[model samples]
Target: MVLEDPSNPLVLRNYAQYLESKRDFSGAEEFYFRATQADPNDGEILSRYAKLVWELHGDQTRASGYFERAAKAAPEDSNVLAAYANFLWEIDANEEEEHSSNAQVDENAVLVDLPAKDFKEEKRPSSPPLHLAMGLGIGRMDLVGINQDYIISCPDDRTTLEEYYKRVVDENPCNPLFLRNYAHFLHQSKGDLHGAEEYYSRAILADPSDGQALSLYADIVWQRHHDKDRAVVYFERAAQATPETVFIPFGFSNVLASYAKFLWEVEDEEDAIEEAKNRMPVGQGTATAANA
Candidate 1:
């Protein structure tokens, strides 16, 4: 019935989503392509299609074009900006030698492997990396990661990660997502647990329900601060927030898994660990939980 109106982009998109849910990638792509053709300027549709193609088919060339079109169509849309920025960042991060040097990278320079003009002719083998599929979705975190502050201070630039994060947090001092992501970045990249805690606390204050921030807060305090009481508080709070969260990506799940490991492995609370494992979606079981 939905396909009866082949010209209706909304129906097509919804049908595409249905097909996607059924694991029918070919059918989903067909409907999504039709929807995009009917409404070429729809940034949201373009973004969805871009992600769909990239994740299912590993067609980075097509995905990049769709992302570019989406950004051009809606230049001010935060979601579009976030996804595009993530795409660029992932491309850079995948490159082996991009960030090896201490010397400043030129402001005028761009990633040579991902030249804008060369995307049209790019090709790939049949088998794509499993990691790419595992890390497909873009969440609020991705949007937060692509702040102009992060972009302007390219990895090649002398501006330190701390400096870049400071600029972003300063730009929107009240934004919880920015604070949360910066905290994660600092913890992961700089190993600055103390600095991360400050930002994570600010993030929680700004929006107490952010499970990602709360989870990370629990992680650092438990791991580094050795504050079991404080850590448990945040962990419980994060678990409470999980059901209401939009989605929990693998990275977020990994953090939770770490906390769960701490409970079962480090803290030796098997009952609480089981409860934590049950909170996550099916298939995200805590079987892989390991020390950080």
Candidate 2:
């Protein structure tokens, strides 16, 4: 097919996938890259290429750029969004591990003469005022938005956000949004998987219909603990709850896509995969099946 029409992105991508399945990573990378060049806007091709670069070549920078591009190219694609999110989570986990190793190295370093002031703890910035407004009759979603804004604005200073999140969740212990957000913060910022799992479980207990929380919890269970049975249960709950979660656009579709991918790739369960395909949104199931 490449000999007949080298510019055909679909053919190129298919060939790349075939090579990947055969463990010819180098050949797969070349064809995936060629496919992306042929069709720059194809999010699937871009995502595949990004995964290949990240996993095989260990080029985090290049992979991150490609993943961002893939998300931008297909914002509505659940698979693309999930893949990008997973990539980010993996990066965070890796960085946390590296930081831990570096801390150990620093602890063992030869003592050097230094000023007493150098040993002083740097004072962290004060928590943002958004949490202070909790008593002003602020809505739950409004608080969520405020927290998100603060986190985005102060990406490097998670200490403030952590304090703010802890306060908010402490006051609103039953609020699923607050609990889930706090759980996510613990997972990403504090590298506290166990803490995150506790909060995620609390979030689910607070609101059984919270699809996003369920899905996120499922991810943690699968990735962190490798508990396949528990993960499947949570994923199924997420998919079932997604339809009632009106705030999330295409929520059901996203859950279905994530569930299908989990079954197909992680578990490799044929019956579960078929069931997931049957539940997926119209054309998406066809595409997934074809790719499989």
Candidate 3:
């Protein structure tokens, strides 16, 4: 019989996921703790637990610790690193490659967002990979900052994360999911746009329809490499193929807007705006006709 509020870690984990899916990050984190204590070897719990820390507070260090656990648990899953690299880029911009320090990225740059991904539910397996891989290392990530001084004083702690992510890429080369994630991390953290471009390209070859690789590969080429022509092509492809995903729109839009801005500065304003509009309508067919 299911307990109304069972103390089982698995049950708590399910509840935590329910809270997270509802956008209640705080609730998820709290329950995730109860779950870890109940079952420290649960990989799914660790992944969500890590992501919860990242999303609610942008605590990359703690989040990274959790990611380590999650990664160890499900060595073949890309979703674990999917949020990590992106959130790492999102938080403390100065620490990421795009921004030299915590000041800003492209002083004139603004956030380019794509349409949100459609949410579809899927059934969970009784024993998922995430649940089995929670072997150990839960406490390390849970600590609120073993090095407080490093956090407040340092404007950029990119090195530590970069090393960690690099190791992830190197150690998990055999797993396509891990390889995809590692490629993604490099794209965001390595400070080598060309290298990032290569990794993302390889990831695409590994998984052609991978939304993460498609958009990130485009970002590296267009934004960092100044190749708007190729960037537009990839952005348009990513937009068309990955319309149903919430995150694709934002990444796709970033490329689109960047290309358009470049065009405006180069006296091709009309075509620039038209191209941006072309990919923005990808989800219209799937959405209700009224909204479309």
Best by lDDT: 2
**Lowest-scoring 10 consecutive residues by lDDT in candidate 3?**
131-140
Off by over 4 Å in 2: 105-292
Candidate 3: TM-score? 0.33
Assess the local accuracy of residue 107 in candidate 2 as a C-alpha lDDT between 0 and 100.
Answer: 38
Candidate 2: pairs in clash: none
TM per prediction: 0.40, 0.43, 0.33
User: Cα miss at 40, model 2 (Å)?
Assistant: 0.5
lDDT string for model 2 (1-25, tens) is 8989899999999999999999999
Top TM-score model:
2
Model 1 agreement with the true structure over 3-85: per-residue lDDT tens digits: 57889889999999999999999889888999999999988789889988887877778888998798668644556656655
By lDDT rank, best first, the candidates go 2, 1, 3
lDDT on C-alpha atoms for all candidate structures: 0.66, 0.73, 0.55
Q: Please state every model's RMSD to the true fold in angstroms.
A: 17.3, 14.0, 22.1
**Which prediction has more favorable lDDT, 1 or 2?**
2
Q: Roughly what TM-score does model 1 have, to 2 decimal places?
A: 0.40
